[model samples]
Structure formats: structure tokens, C-alpha cells
Target: MAHHRVADGKNSLRRRGVSRGLVFMLLAVLLVASGVVVWFQVGDHVGREGDAAAATCVEGPATVAIIADPDIAEGLSAIAKSYAETRPVIRDHCITIAVRPGDAKITLDGLTGNWDPQANGQYPAAWIPQSSVWAADLVTAKPSVVDGTPESLVTSPVVLATSPELGAQLTGKLDWAQLPTLARRDDSLTEFGLRGWGSLRMAMPTGAQSDASALAAQAVAMRITRTTGVLTAADASSKGVAAGIGALTEAAPRSPDGTPVGAATAIADAADAADAKAAPIHAVPITEQRLFQLTKADTTAKLAEVLPSGPTPLADYPFLKLTGDQVPEYAATAVADFFRFAEEPDHLAVLTALGFRGAAPMPPKTATVTFPVTPNPMASPETAAVVDINRLVFGPTS
Candidate 1:
């Protein structure tokens, strides 16, 4: 009996010891797994933070951000690409530039009031708007942020264009003043073999609202107030002036309900349309550069140009430098370097090839079309403000 009791006590002691061993083994395995998990988690966090730090630690001259009008974006982009390859070094630091195309109004809006770099995408170290008119309007409305006078990179005059077939039927160079009277005459449409929609459809840009259209409006206002050389409040209020301007609006070629079509594309489409019944866009007010592009693109659709008389509004592509904190320390010098590079005769030649009138005298063929070398004529900011109001009351609803 004593031996049986002793054996039972020994078995119970061994069983308890084995159970404790298994518990310790399980705890050890769990502790090791937890340590590995903690190590990986810590490592991943550090890695991500390190990547973030590296991303923002770019050294050397800051990359220049150039925002430009879409009309000249392609040409500017090409110029930028060429500049990047050359890698012009400024102040012993290599400089780089990035170009983006945006709407002129949107870019102008972005440039206004305590310009925020991040909100404006990147600080516009340089801005090349379609015309100096926009820059002038901006400067007149708000104090300019431009470091100095905006450099005119290229120039183009506003011109009238029509398809070859339609142009052939029109009488001698049409005067800008005659446009309103002609718009009211239906007989002129019949003279061109155009009837109904195909008749003498005239297209003008949306005045005040669109830069191009506003320019056209300024041209009209110039004709209205040429003796004074500036549009005045009285001129805007004049019944005859208002009537003429209204006639321009009434004559614009649009959809059935008068929705404005894209000025260039509409003209091109009219020229290319297969159906003879499709009303051809008889005449459109556009820039000579644009006319050149359309004619160059389609051999079948030969667009002829009629230069506007008087002090015509020219598209002087201005290079504006952003001032204040919006611009980096190195940007101005780099911009100066770029300007120097661009002004070189060779670079000017390249710009001319892209359908711009460069700084240097162009070839004879390009010179045939006259544009003022030093045009001072532009609608005043106050005049533009009034025009905006008038357009709302007198222009198309669309």
C-alpha cells in the first residue's frame, strides 16, 4: 500500500512539471513572434519617413515653373525642351525649367492677390500670356508683380480670314468699319452663292469674356473713338456705337440657339464639311498666327488673310516674371539667362518658324503683312470694365 501511494505521488509531480514546460515553450514562441512583428512595423515606418525626406531634399537651382497661354503652349514647350537640352548654367548652378499651358484668364486669376505657390500649382517663375493686353489689364487692375517690363517674345496682328472659295467672291479688302453695315445686308450673302445658314455668317469672339473677343471689341471701340485714341464712357454709351457693337454680336455665327462655337475649329469645320448644304463659315476674326496654322494644316482649305486697318490689337506674347515669395531666389537670374538665349538671332529664327514674328526683322514674305513696330494703342482698364458690363447687357446670353 505504501509503494502504490508513493508511485501515484511521483506520477502527479512529473505530470505537473511537463505541463509547466509546455506553457514556457508556448510563451517563448509567442514572445519571439511579437518581437519580429514590432521590428518590421518600426522598420516600415522609418523607411516611409526616409523616403518622404529624400523627396523634398532636392538641391541646386530650383526648377522654374512657366505657365503660358494654350494658344502658344506648343511653341513655348518646344522652346523649353530645346532649352532643357542645352542646360544653360546660371550663377554656377545648373538651371531647369518646367512649362505648363493653361487658360489666360485662369492663369491671371491665379496670379492675383498674395499669390500662393502651392495653390497656383507651382510658383510661376515666368508667365507668357497670349497678349500684352492681358498683362496691361492686370497691371492696371492690380499692382504688377513682374520684376521688370514684360518682354515681348513674339507678335501677331488680329486678321480676318475666310475660305478660298468664299474669299474669292468678296470685294476688295473689307474695311473694319464696314463690317457692321455688311452684317445687316443679306444681299452680300447671295453674292457669295451662300443662302440661309451658308450665307455671310460672321464670327466674332465673346467680347470682354474672352481675351480674343475682348481684343476684337477693343478694335471696334478704337474705330468708334479713333480721334481720341481711347475708348471713353461716352463712346460706350453712344447709341450708334452701341448699335454697331450689337450688330457685331447679332452677326456672330453660332448654333441655332446662338451658342458660341470654337472660333478656329468652327471655321476649319465649315471649310472641311462634305455637305454642300452645310453653311460655310464665311468670315472670322482671328489672329494671323492662327490663320497661318489652319492654312498650313489643311492644303484643301486655303484660308486668306485680310489685315485689319488702323492701330490693330497685336498679340504680343509677354514674358512676365513673378515677384515676391512666389518666385525663388535663383529664378530671376535664370529667366534673364533664358531671355538672353532667346534673343539670340538663332533662337529668334526658330520662333519665327513656329509662326511668330520674332524680335529680329523677318524674311520678306513675312514682312508683307504690316504690323506696328511700337504700337501704344490698347483699351484702358476702365474701358475694359465698362465693356464687360455692356457685354452682359448687349452681348449674347450664351
Candidate 2:
């Protein structure tokens, strides 16, 4: 019995030893697997860190805020989206552009001073006002308001827009110089065979109204003074120019509520309504872009746009940067990159698609009727001259 018990004990000891050996092998395998996984994970993280350091991507992404004219805002926003998708890296960080459409007069007013938060919000990092006229206003008030020479992104010519009835009669019949003499005359339109139409009543957008209107007023001053090149501040203050400006303003339709009225509302209203014998306003100076927008928005309503003969003023959409000694290197670099991107032929296509003349100068796709438009930079009146004349034409808003 004792010998049998001893054999069973030996067998039990062997079984125990085998179980211990299997457990040891399993633990060893788990430890090896875990070590391999940990090695790969650490190596991947190190590699990515090395690449980031090499790429110099040291800062958080930068968001660039750009304030653009309401007229050009849609097109500008489209281009801004494309810029972001292209993934531009300025100063070693990804860039995002946020475009906000702003009023030309308010933006001009903001930079010119007397900025009320309720009237003008915080100044944007950069601005694309409707024309250099606003910039000229700044220069007249304060020269250092700009950091550098303003760059024009694209050129839009100002044209007279009227209801079909009036446009049909006036196309190519008169020039900018003829306006002052005719605008206030009771029989001005009747002379053009618009018997019941009263006068050649014209609406000129000024100050807070529109950049195009301001330019048109300057055109009148230039013609009145017989001055070429640019209308000087002296020309604006001259008796002849003031009289011309006043006459032009006198022809504008009176506001029903005794509030400010611009050409945009009148044109839009005419476009929405049927042709009537008594139109609210007869004619207005508008940009090619606006003419396109007015017609395109409602195909049923059409406006007759005529490029008045002689030296016509152009809307130079100038790009300006808010400059100060405090501007950081990154901010300036971002501005430069954005400007270059906007000027690229590929991106300028965006503007041309929207009926604008590109940086390369394309024939206005917006022109329904073909009139020769040779856009010369010299055609733009001096900004300072336009600014002074506007005070005479529109008077002060406040």
C-alpha cells in the first residue's frame, strides 16, 4: 500500500510542474507582445513630432479678417474660400479668411475718425473700400492713416443707369460735362423728347451712399472746371464746380421720410415695378457690377446703362491695410500673401465670372449692349479732389 501511494505522489508532482511551465510560457508571450506594441506607438509619435519641428509649424492657425465692399463682397467671399482650400501657409501656420461685407461710407468714416461703435464697428485689419476716393478722403483728413500706397484690386467704370424709357432716349446723346447745364433745367428731359419726364433728374450717390456716386460727382466737377488729370481740391471748392454739384443734387428725388436716399433704392424699385409715367428718380450713376446685379437679380426688369461720353471716372477698388507701429510681422506677411493670392490670374477668374474687370482687365461681361470702354487709370479723378467735392454735393450726413 505504501509503494502504491509513493507512485501516485510522484505522478501528482510531475503534473504540477507541467502546469507551472505552461503558465510561465503564456506570461512571457504576453510581455513580448505588449513590448512590441509599445515600441511602434512611441516611434510613430516621435516621427510626427520630428516632422512638425522640421515644417516650422510652430503656432496655432491664423484667422485673417477682411472687410470688403458689399458690392464686391460675394465675389470676394468665393475667392476667400478657394484660398483656404488651397491651404496657404503664412508664417508657418495654416490660414483661414473671414470676409465681412461693409458699407463704403461707414468704412471710410471709420478710418477718417468720428467713429462711433453704433455707427462704425471696430476697424478691420484690412479694408477693400469701393474706390480710392475714400482713401483720398483719409489722406485729405490725415495722410498717415494708410501704411503704404493703396493697391487697386480691379476697375469698375461708373455708368448712368435709368429705366428703359429714359435710357433709350439718352444713350450716347450727352456727356459728363453736359450734366450740370441740363440736370436742373425743367425742360432737360423734354428736350430729349421726354416731355412728361420733367428734367434730366439724376441721383448721385455720395458719402455714405456709394463710391460710384461720389465718383460721378467728381466727374461733374472735373468737367465744370475744365480740368484734366485729377480734379483738385481747389476745383471742388470753385464756384462753378459747387454750382454744378448743387444743380446735380437738386435733380435728385426728394425723400418721402426726409431721410437720406441713394440711387440703389430707386433703381431696385424701378426694376421691381412696371414702367410708369411718373418714375421716382430719373437716372443715377452706377458701377458696371451694380448694373449687372440689378439686371441679373430680376431678368424681367432691365436697366439701360450708358457710358456717358468724354472722360468718365472709374471705380478703383483699392486694397488698404491698417498700418501702425504695432502691426506684427505675421499680420503684414498675411496681408501680403492674401494680396498676391487675390491678384493671381487663376483667382481673378472668380471676379471676372461675377461681371467684373479682372486685374488683367477683361471686357465687362456685364455689358448687355456693347459700348467701347477703354479703362485708363488716368480716367480716375484725384481722390482728394473727389473727397472735397463730395462735401459740396452731398453735404454732411450728421
Candidate 3:
């Protein structure tokens, strides 16, 4: 009986040891499974971190293409070049800007088609044009092209630029009301002069009329002719036109091209000679802002801005982006940054220096004045005619 009880106790001890061993194996399996799960989770987190770093580091330089009239281009390019030197921010990324000059309409037209994801003809990050009206047309055509509404960075008024002597005789000081009286005559002053308006006074001569300068002058002349009873260029030559022509002749010398020489070179040369002449001819330089860094000294000494007697047409410059299948990530970033930066006081001051009025918070309504309708080169002829007719009558200089 004693032997049997000892054997039974030994059997019980062996069963307990087997159960404990099984429990230890199960615990080991569970620990190994938990370690595998933890390893995957940590690996995923590290992979995501690496991807984010690559995205941020791999971005290329940001560039902007500006389409502007030559006059505005000169000023805008200078500003953009200066801005690029500083390397501004775009989505926490450093940006590099490029400015290309061309007709505003033609430049926007080229933005259509397939864009390579990398390299040549890829896509412009941003576009700045001479007129805000052009920007509106672009947005209307393809609303999705740009990320947001176009913004204006600057404002400039179209003015009649004339030789110093002729400028002096026309209004004593430049005045818009007197313009109608100046466009009536058939005299040499009203004729298209090849050498420009400076030829009327042989004392201070300057060269030919620039295409742009001539167009602007014609627009002004047309506005005045429309206001008075003069219809054709011939009607402008009548005796009634004589008084007007005489006034213009007094202020400006007529060129052989039947236009006044208002080119920058001509104006600068005329200004340089103003001090030596018996009658100091002053260039009739007109702009909205009374102050400009380039013209401030001249304003204080020889230059003057002729404020319109009535409401005048205001020029609005627009920045735009063209449509594409996939919007560039960097383009959106650069545009947002530029708009924000342009609105600041310091930046506005730079615009002011360049003969632009800082963009106002409130834009004037389309119906405010009857003169100077914004031209949309892309518009249908019928639509263009309507705009031109409405614009032909009222602005300071059409």
C-alpha cells in the first residue's frame, strides 16, 4: 500500500510539469506575434517620413512669366528681377522667378496644350499682364485654369506725353479739359510728323515717333475730335481746328511723321536741353500718382501730372494663371505668396515709384464712366465694337 501511494504522487508531479511547459510555449508564441506587429507599424511610420522629406527636397525653382506692354515691361521686369534676387517663399519652399516680355494677348494664348511634367515648356508658375481686363477674359475662358481670382499689383493712367515746349503752350500746366481745344486744327501741329513734335521748334529737335507712342497720341486726338464737331482728320484741319492746333504747336513741336515725339529718349533729351533754351520746354508727362522714384525729381523741378477734369479711365494690371490638366503644386504656392506680398505697404510703395497707383481695396464698377473701355483682343468683333463705342467718348485719353 505504501509503494502504490508514492507512485501515484510521482505521476501527479509529472502532469503538473507538462501543463507548465505548454503554458510557457503559448506565451512565447504570443510575444513573437506582438513583436512582428510592432515592427510593421514602425516601418510604415519611417517610410512615410522619408516620402515627405523627398517631396519637400525635390521641388525645382519657381518661375513667373510676365506679358506686358514695353512701357510697363521695363518697370515690371526691374521689380521682378529685384524680387528674385531675394529668393522669396512659396509653400515653405524657396522660389526662383523669371520674367519674359511679349504682347499680353499673345502670351496668354500660348498657354494651351500638353505640358511636360519636367523640363522645357512644362508650364509657367504665374503670369502678370499689363491690364486687369485681360486677366478677366482669361478667367472667363477657363475658370479652372487659375487657382483663384486674378489680383492687381499696380495701376497706371494713360497720359499724353509731349515735348516740353509744346506741352507748355497747350495748357501752361497740363489739363485734360483743354485737350479738345488742341485737336481742332489742320496745322503742322495736328499733322503726323516723322521726326515727332519736336521739329516745330528747331531749337530742341528729337527723332521719330514710336509706334506705341503714336497709337496713344492718336487715341487722345480721336477722343478730342469726337468731343468737338470734328469727324475726319480733314475736318480737324479746318479753321475751327486752327485754335486747337495753335495751342498744341505752342506747347509741342510737330515731327515729319505727323505725330509728337514722346518717346523716352526724346523726352529725356528735351528735358536735358530745357535749361539752356529761351523758352524752357517742359515734357508734358502725365501719370496718376503724384510721386514716383524716377519722376519725383522731375516733378519737383520740370514735370507735372495733369489730373483729368472729369472722371478719367483708370488702368488696371492683372496677374493670371493658365488652365492645365494638372495644376502645378509650386505654381499655386508662388501665386498665393506673390498676391499676399504685393498687397503689403512696402511693395505698394515700389509700385508707386514705378508710376503706378497701389491697387485699391475697392475696385470701381464697370458702369462708372463711359470712356476708355478695356479692350479684349480675344472678344468677337461684335462685342469689341460695342465696347469701343462705349469707350470712345469719355476718358481723359482714350
Candidate 4:
């Protein structure tokens, strides 16, 4: 009886030891699983923290103000939006750009003299006028205003825009020299078999709003003087040039409401009108970029572009960073960063898409372009000369 009781006690002790071993093993497994979970959670948090630190803007959200020419403002605005989306960091500052349209003359006045921030919006960090002529004027008026050599972001030739039918009819028959006579003629379109069109009507750009009219006037002065080199101020004010420009101004079209039509697209839009005599604008001087955009908007756009046989002025959109004692270093850095992005092949595509001749711009498929790529030697295109010619063409600046 004693041996049996001893055997039972030994078996109970062994069972207890076995149970303890099983518990230790289970606890070990649980500890390892918890450790793995903690490690993964900590790693994820660190990774997220690293990313946040990189993206976090530490210094600033700097706004670079750009005073763009009205014509180029829309394109620049688009690029600026893209730039913001990328969260560009310039000089340790998160950067963005703002584009505002400022008339070349008015903006120059404000720039050279005093900038009424209330009237002119923000004090500009950069300025893009329709032509380098404005930059030259800036240099002449205030040599210290411009920081560096102004470079052209895009180039657009001023072309004659008309309906496809009328442009085709006038082909080989028209020249810039003959334009004044055509404007003054009694029956302008009859010779071309365009009978319904009475006298030649046009939307001559003369206001200081855009550089198109000024360029056209410069072309007129160039032809009248018969000079191919850079036009002098005296050459632009020749009597013959004034008379020639005067004739075209007299031919300005009147809308059905008897309001004077000065829009370059008036002639092109007239072609799509249901009425034959709706907007009887025979022709107008316009930038190729404007024409390209106008046609791109409408699938069934009906227009033709004609390049003059003679030299035509170019709208070289100049990018100028303003300089003065008050200009900030960070602003200049921001402008340069934006300009660098703009010069990239991808960004240049944006300008090309907008219709300016930038980064290998192609011809528009919508309009029939006679001379899409080439140009003759320009004349009298200097700012002062252009200003003189503008005076003759558009009259004195208001």
C-alpha cells in the first residue's frame, strides 16, 4: 500500500511540471508576437514622420508677384498654377507665383514712377510686357529698374486675320503697301468677286490696350520709309507713313449697333455669323498667338491668316525682373526658379499650346496660315520709333 501511494505522488509532480512548461512556451510565443506588432507600428510612425518633415514648409510660403502683359498673362497664370501644385521650394521657402495683366504704358508709368498698389495690384517682382521695346524704355527711363538682360519667353508675329474665303480671295493680290489704297478705295472687295462687301472695313487695333495696333503702325512706317534696318524715330513720323496709317484708321468697322469695332477677332467672327452683313469687318491686324487660341476654342473656326510680303513687327514677350533698393533677394530667387521651370521643355509646351512661338511652336490646324514660320527683316521696331508710329496710327496716348 505504501509503494502505490508514493508512485501516485511522483506522477502528480511530473504532471504539474509538464503544465508549467506548456504555460512558459505559450507566454514566449505571445511575447514575440507583441514585440513584432510594436516594431511594425513604430517603423510605420517613423516613416510617416520622415515624409511629413520633408513636405513640411519650415520657412515661408512666398508669393512671387509677376506683372505679365495682358496677352501672355493667361498662359503664365496656367503655368503658375502648375508650379504651386508641385509645391516648389525656393531658397528654403515654399514658393508660388501670381500673374497680373498690366498695360505696357500704364505699367511702365507705375514702374518708373510710383506704384499705386491700390490701383496696380501688388508691387511687381517681375514684369512681362508685349515687347522688348518696353524694356528698352524702362532702361532709358530708369536704368537701375531692370535687374538683368531681359529675355524673350515667346515670339508672335502680327498677321492679317480674315475669313477663310476673303483671305483666299485677296491672296497674291494684296501687299502692305497697297493696304492704304485698298482702305481708301470705293469698292474694295468687288475686284476679288466679293460683291456684297462694299468698301473695305477693318478692326484696326489702335488703343494702348495691346501692342498689335502699334506693331501694324510700325509696319506701315517701315514700308513708307522703305528701310529694312532698325527704324529711327524720325523714320516712323514720316508724312507718308502718317497718311497711310490714317487711311486704315478711317476704315475702322462699325458694328450693327453702330459701335466702333476694334477687336482683332471681329473680322474672323463675322465669317461664322448667320447674317451675310452681320459684322462686316474685312480684315484686322492680330497676333498669330491670338489667332491660334481663337481657332482652338471653336472646332468649326473659320479664319485665314495672311503674312505681309513686307516686314512685320514681332510681339516678343519679354520676361523682366525688376530691380531696386527695395527688391528682396528671396523674390529674385523665386522669379528665377519660376523662369527656370518655364524654360523646361514641358513648360515650354504650355506656351506653345497657348499659341505663342515658344519652344518650337507648330502651326495651328484650325486656320489656313499662308506664312506660318518665316519672317522678313524687321524695320523701325525700336520702342521710341514704335511709340512715334503708334502716335501716328492710334493718336496720342489718352
What candidate 3 gets wrong by more than 4 Å, as runs, is: 1-94, 105-123, 133-149, 163-181, 186-304, 325-329, 359-398
> Where does model 1 exceed 4 Å of error?
1-59, 85-92, 113-120, 185-199, 207-210, 228-240, 255-261, 271-277, 360-398
Per-residue lDDT over 1-398 for candidate 3, one digit per residue giving the tens place of the 0 to 100 score: 45644556655665435577899999999999999999999999999987676556445555644345444556556666667766665554566555555554444455543334343344565666554434544554455666665666775554444343444444334334354343333343433332233223321122221222222332344344453322344433434444443344354543333322332224445534433243233333233332133244453223333333322434456666544544466656665665565576765665655556664332221211111332311111122222232222111111
Please report, in order, the local distance difference test score of every candidate based on alpha carbons.
0.62, 0.69, 0.44, 0.73
Candidate 2 off by > 4 Å:
1-51, 54-56, 112-123, 206-209, 255-277, 297-301, 359-372, 375-378
Clashes of 3: 29
Listed per candidate, the RMSD to the true structure in angstroms reads 20.5, 12.7, 12.5, 10.9
- Give model 3's TM-score versus the native structure: 0.47
Query: Considering only N, C-alpha and C atoms within 3 Å, which residue pairs clash in candidate 1?
Result: none
How badly does each model clash, as a count of residue pairs?
0, 0, 29, 1
Q: State the TM-score for model 4.
A: 0.74
Indicate the residue-level lDDT of 111 in model 3: 50
Query: If the candidates were sorted by their TM-score against the true structure, best first, what order would they fall in?
Result: 2, 4, 1, 3
lDDT of 4 by residue, 1-398 (tens): 45644556655665435577899999999999999999999999999986666567567677879988776898889889988998887656677799988877788898888888888887888999987656766776787988888787778888777777777787667767777877789876687787766666766754454466667767777777887788887787778877888888877664333212245456555644323467667777777777676666565647778777788778888889887755678788888788888888777777777677777556556635433655584643666776676566556544
Return the top candidate by lDDT: 4
Per-residue lDDT tens digits for candidate 2, residues 281-353, read 6677778766775566454545677777767777777888766543455666777778888899888877766
- How do the residues 302-329 of candidate 1 rate in per-residue lDDT, one tens digit apiece? 4555654555666778888767775767
C-alpha lDDT (0 to 100) for residue 263 of candidate 2: 55
